[model samples]
Target: MTTSPLRRNTLKLSLLTLILMGFVLSGCSGEGESWNGKDISGLMPGLEFELTDGQGRPVTADQFDGKIKLLYFGFTSCPDVCPTTLQKLGQATESLPTEAQDDVLTLFISVDPERDSPERLAAYVDFFGNGIVGLTGKESQLRQLAKRYRTTFGYEEPDENGNYAVSHSSAVYVFDREGKARLLIRPDLGVEEIRQDLIALAKADT
Candidate 1:
């Protein structure tokens, strides 16, 4: 029996889709429980930063030097990505053993410093129900850090209602215990996958 034209087209499309998926999976999938994120261990985009914490204290990246860190650039008012990623980071780390959990820290650096004051950052960070350390600083300092990390963020003009929006990078940067940037995790990765990767990175040098 001859197949219909529609069925032939469908088969072709499905084959093409599978080919594309194979390429993506091969390029993106790290070793399941080993380096499950994109390995940038030797890359220099996320070297360091000098910023303030949620409580308005002067803090620098080196201050978190000895611990593994997860860094993301966003604002308290971010409509979705920032908060969700923070929660994922929180949940993933919490899945670790107590001692392993202690080895990891997540930094939510505010790209909208003008609106994300220390007080606002504290409330926003706390609302996520985890131990993320909120941070913000002068635009100049943040801008420099963004440049170094290749993270981009900017504010749109305010609307008639005096509201605005920001466009920023959504990559989760993982730094090892030695302060060397290691993995660039995609925000859309699965929670379990991230949990496993976080554990692997945290214990890599320990």
Candidate 2:
């Protein structure tokens, strides 16, 4: 007995749907592949700004023209959030392929320039990893950079012991090769999620 034409067409449609579903699942399952760091393309097409590095050197957005940049704002004295986030970023960078690694830059900018001097900032960043750059400058300059990035930070008064805490935004801003802001990752995100987003932005064609 032969199958009816209607039944045959129904089977064909069902098979096609199954194939499509498989493709979608495969893409989602291999999200890790995007974290390899070579996939950010056209994410942040073009943007430019100037800020100081931990060493007091003038670091401009142009310096990162051909690479993906992870920009974070916090003071050196940040007791918890800053260090934790930076460490996670270090891990994500380590997980990238070498070629992609070379194209990645992580910048830590001090919002409390009154206390976080260039030397102090440099030392703080160096403790994390090699590719991480620390940045601090005049209060005015630092404030300008923070404003451009829409990051806010403030320092609490010191206690009787002359120690205080700095409270600041903990979002990691991802910029494409051209310096445009592409995505923002909060400190609470999983390391894997951060890695995957970075990889996807890196693979973009900007």
TM-score, every prediction = 0.81, 0.73
Tens digits of lDDT, candidate 2, 1-206: 98754455445545543553343344443443334322222332344557776657887778778887888888877788888999999988888877677778888878777788888888999999878988767778766676665444555557898877665666677777767665556556777777777666667643
Compare the candidates by TM-score and give the number of the best one: 1
Question: In lDDT terms, how accurate is model 2?
Answer: 0.69
| Candidate 2's TM-score | 0.73
Model 2 regions lying over 4 Å from their true place:
1-47
Root-mean-square deviation of each candidate, in angstroms?
10.0, 16.7
The numbered model that scores best in lDDT is 1
Please give the CA lDDT of all the candidate structures: 0.76, 0.69
Off by over 4 Å in 1: 1-33
